[model samples]
Target: MAHVTFGGKPVTLLGNEVKVGDKAPNFTVLDNALNEKTLDDFKGVRIIASVPSLDTGVCDAETRRFNEEAARLDGVSVLTVSVDLPFAQKRWCGAAGLENAITLSDHRDLSFGKAYGVVIEGLRLLARAVFVVDSNNNVTYVEYVKEVTEHPNYEAALEAAKRAK
Candidate 1:
């Protein structure tokens, strides 16, 4: 369980909290075209960024930042995940001019949130978090942002991705 706060109020998380050294769990998410994507689909270093919803301001900015960083991270795959529908994710990506990072949807079943322990129990949203996966499928770093409405540590997450790569 993750102790998280949404809008300053403590909220419950409904899944197991993973940490560094744990094998990254394999879960399915929908891509922009509604295709199923799993951890196995992306090879090499992986940065899995979780957000509550992409429609929000914080999430939009965070994802765009990651998209900008992704271009610089050659050979690394960056995934921005949210509970928003795939259609909405596609629209957001297009509107934001995001091309480097992939936007995935966990709205179907919240599989990614549950597998990554980011599921917000009450709101049915995902808590902000970031996970770095090495080529060997091992989790090298994990950050569960304490505040849901705030931005995550972008520098730290990028550093971990670089190290893992």
Candidate 2:
């Protein structure tokens, strides 16, 4: 498992830690409309970004950055997963005017968080991380941010997505 921290304090993460070259784990998350979504639903290259909550500052900025980048990345689907409720996620997207990236809620069950090894043991939130999965469902890039409050390496993740077939 990757060592991570929240607010500079060490935190334990639960689940099987994902890594580059591993097959992307399947997860069930709720879309804005409360529809269940799974890994198979999204075709082509996928950028799966996990965050604690969409309400927080770091998560907000990260999602927004991905939204902007999604516009230029052809055939790439950017999915942001958080423990925030579907309604709250929808509202945030609306207020933020985010069109390119889709927000999914893992609040019902830590399905996405646990599957992707981003679950914060005691927090009931996901640790900050990003996984770029190619069309074949192979994880091409993985980034587990050491600090939950910081943003990920956008350039590297984006480059991996571009290279994924």
Candidate 3:
């Protein structure tokens, strides 16, 4: 379990984030259309798992930023996961005109968040985290924000993902 903060208050994470040398965990999440998707479906491409909660302002900023960045990368795909329902995710994405990254809902099976070590126990939200997986399914970069209210290191993450050669 990893330790993180929500609004500067200490909060404990349930699971462990995929380490730099660890193989990415295989899990299923629902797409905006409510269709099931797995890690294997995105093989041979750089994957940036941006786990966040749509209910928070920081998460909203993170998702929007990633959505814009994801569109510029040719072989990279960003999958944003949240506990919100697919319908809500669709509505937000459409309203924001976010067309690059694919937003997946983990409301049904909290397993994805659990496996990624981003689940907040008491609250029904996910701790903010960024995981970059290489084409071989190995985690190349992992960042679990110490403060939930803070934005992630987008520059470092984007550079790492873009350097996959």
| Highest-scoring model, TM-score | 2
Q: Which of the two, 1 or 2, has more lDDT?
A: 2
Question: Residue 81 in candidate 2 has what lDDT?
Answer: 95
Give me the runs in candidate 2 sitting further than 4 Å from their true place: none
- What TM-scores do the predictions have? 0.96, 0.97, 0.92
Per-model tally of clashing residue pairs: 0, 0, 0
40-155 per-residue lDDT for model 3 (tens digits) = 87865555554556656877888888768866887887888888899988888887777445888888988778778888878878888888888988888888888878999998
Comparing 1 and 2 on TM-score, the stronger one = 2
Q: Once model 2 is optimally superposed onto the true structure by TM-score, how far is the C-alpha of residue 61 displaced, in angstroms?
A: 1.0
Winner by lDDT:
2
Question: Candidate 2 at 47: error in angstroms?
Answer: 0.5
- Give me the runs in candidate 3 sitting further than 4 Å from their true place: none
Computed on alpha carbons, the lDDT of every model, listed in order, comes to: 0.89, 0.92, 0.79
Which window of ten consecutive residues has the lowest lDDT sum in model 3? 43-52
Clashing pairs in 1: none
* RMSD of model 1 against the true structure: 1.0
